[model samples]
Target: MTAPLARDTARERSRRRAARRNLRSALLFLSPWIIGFSVFTAWPLLYSAYLSLTDYDVIRDPRFVGLDNYAQLAQDPKVLQSLGNTAFYTLVQIPLYIVVTLALALLLNRAGQRAGLFRTLFFLPKMTPPVAVGILFLLLFNGQNGLVNGALRTVGITGPSWTTDPAWIKPGLILMSLWTVGSSVLILLAALQNVPTELYESARLDGAGFWRQSWSVTLPLISPALFFIVVVNTIAGLQTFDEAYTAFFGAGNTTYSNDAALFYVIYLFQQAFEFLHMGYASAMAWVLFALILVVTGIQLLVSRRLVYYEGGQR
Candidate 1:
């Protein structure tokens, strides 16, 4: 009995030692990512939280100010205006973006052997830098001698001043958003191809026509990809800054309607860099983060019903 007990204890000790060795090996492999995340992502996140509670400019140490910045945010008219503009952009752009991308993906999917070439051609626009796109937009929509107006003139219709008119600015931006529909198109196209041909055959056997088959089979199978595109586009639309800033605020131009183009991120940039309101900007950043979190949460809840997963778990 004593001999058997001693052997059991020895085996347990060996297992414990092996487990410790495995843990150390895992830690050694994970060290680079852990260290990088701590320095770059975690530290910035924590420091921003602290900065949001204090007044900090680059020149001086952060002065503790509690909730004063958040209080000011509520009363700031520009904050309200920017939020409204961002909300409008998200609402209008997302549906149009999803429809256009889906339609293009369907068209490309039918191209068979020629699909690759068409995909490359469509994706070329997305490779252009945002600043260059903004400049291109300004040139194309210049109202007087622009290519768009030139074409409109031949058609006996006058194109509105897209850059200068507040009424046309958001619509122009929405149109510009379509220029990068290639990414979503590719995603949907992949999803469309992944859908089993058996499902379509079954639909055809049931006497379903083209529209009926698409509505019943194609949409349900590709619903997950569509949901993904919607959420991503919504987030991007809300954070719209680069193109609007380059077009309207860059090079000290004062002709365009800033109110129409003043997206939430652009205002946040102005507060942080242009005005040196670090604390206020930090607060704005946190508020935007919270808003995005809530919106994403709501989307997740909604997607439980809308998004289809083949494995049966939402």
Candidate 2:
């Protein structure tokens, strides 16, 4: 071979060897995350899918049962009831959550540096444990002698029995859920800070007041953040468990209506740990996963029109 041709061939071989070495190094660096995901996330997901098709009680070997568990779920009235309760909680709570958080964000944005202490104080509530929050809910919303009713009585207004009455139970839960909107408030506050000040100035020049500028300028700019919060909260609201379970289903609690507060995850928990229906709970989990996918898809479709991006791309 000619000298120039031999040199070109050698350079090509060296580049190929370097490429292989770089690929190996990259894989080595990523090995930990890859192994963790395989063990913790991917394997569990696949195993759950397999378990969903069987009759396993965490005691004996799983026996193949085909679609029997799903068929039973279809016939279960509690499924519908729990789903309805969860839907109601999500639908009612999300709007109120958005409004309250946005309002707080607006107030904080206006407060400027003076709001530093208030912002920290607002976030402190979110640091409280879920079980403690549930207990606090019972105390604050108690029917006969709670602080809420006491304040209502001072105004000559009768307060409903929040803990006992079925009608008030869900409302009380919703109110309790609102008590931890600190993270959402912080998210919105950050979004508000990112809104271009020039847009507000232009709105003002066009004779727009605070409300008009907010509606036209602020909301559209921060819509992506709002969409994120809505999606996240919707997923969380559907999986409602810890607080409601602590409030109504924990030991020494037989007063609240199960129909009012039996969220989907709580029912799934009952089936798995309480009843040892491991296979059934696995099916329930997959159903929830499917529902979340559908709901999130719908939200994404709706967000195409609602959520505005600065670069005009969703």
Candidate 3:
């Protein structure tokens, strides 16, 4: 009995030793991610917050300017236009995206066709690099010999110079934006398919029609996902740079002519990199962060009236 007890104690000690070794190994394995996060994400975020409060160009020491940058943003006409442009873009894009995405999701959810082929076809636009797509769209909407104009000519109507004309540039870019709406459709389609079939079946027993079942059953179930897509796409639209900048060619004194195609970020980039105003750009980034937070909070608050959760009390 004594010998057996001694052996068991020895085994327990060995297990403890092995556990400590495994923990050490695990920590070693996780160190890379820990280091990367600290270096790339945490450090830069903290530094940027600090930079926002100072007026430091890259070549000089930063001077603490307090709220001067924020004050400037408030009074700047270009900033106001950019803000308005972004707001308009967000307002137009979010709903259009939601409608188009939901329509596609519903259509494809029951499409019964080979979903893989159709899904690939729709998602191809999303896969295209934004820069490439923007460049292609630039030509497609051109007034002369552009595909859109050619099509319009065929119909005995004229198309305006899309990129060159201020009146049509934003609209042309907005149309370009539609090409990537496919990604949202795919997201909504997933949400639609995730909805319980039993709910629709039960609703049918109550003499509900297709639209009725969808209104009460489908929409509610998918509301959570739709809500997420709305917020994300709104943020994306607010950060509209790649398409607008790539499609735009500031041929004259227009930094963001034709109604300020330079959305906040694009304008910020021009100020920071083009004009070498790092401190000001940093301030813009902070403002953008605040704006996004406020907008997102508003959405979440407003969503309470619209978004319905399953199996949980609101």
Per-residue lDDT tens digits for candidate 2, residues 201-305, read: 899889999889988999899999999999999999999998889989988577776568889999999999999999999999999999999999999999998
- What C-alpha lDDT values do all the predictions have? 0.91, 0.93, 0.83
- By summed lDDT, which 10 consecutive residues of candidate 2 come out lowest? 252-261
Q: Which numbered prediction scores highest in lDDT against the true structure?
A: 2
TM-scores of all predicted structures: 0.95, 0.96, 0.87
Q: Report, for all candidates in order, the number of backbone clashes.
A: 0, 0, 0
Q: Give the per-residue lDDT of model 3 (tens digit) for 1-314.
A: 99999999999999999999999999999999999999999998888888778898888898999888888888888888888888877887778778888888888899756676788889898988887877788679877888999999999998888877766776778777889877788888898888888988898999999989989899888899999998998889889887777767433334334564668888888888788877788889889999999999999999998998877533
Q: What is the lDDT of residue 19 in candidate 2?
A: 100
lDDT tens digits, residue span 122-167, model 1: 8999999999988988888888898888999999999998888898
Residue 12 of model 3: what lDDT? 100
| Candidate 1 local distance difference test against the native | 0.91
Better of 2 and 3 by TM-score: 2
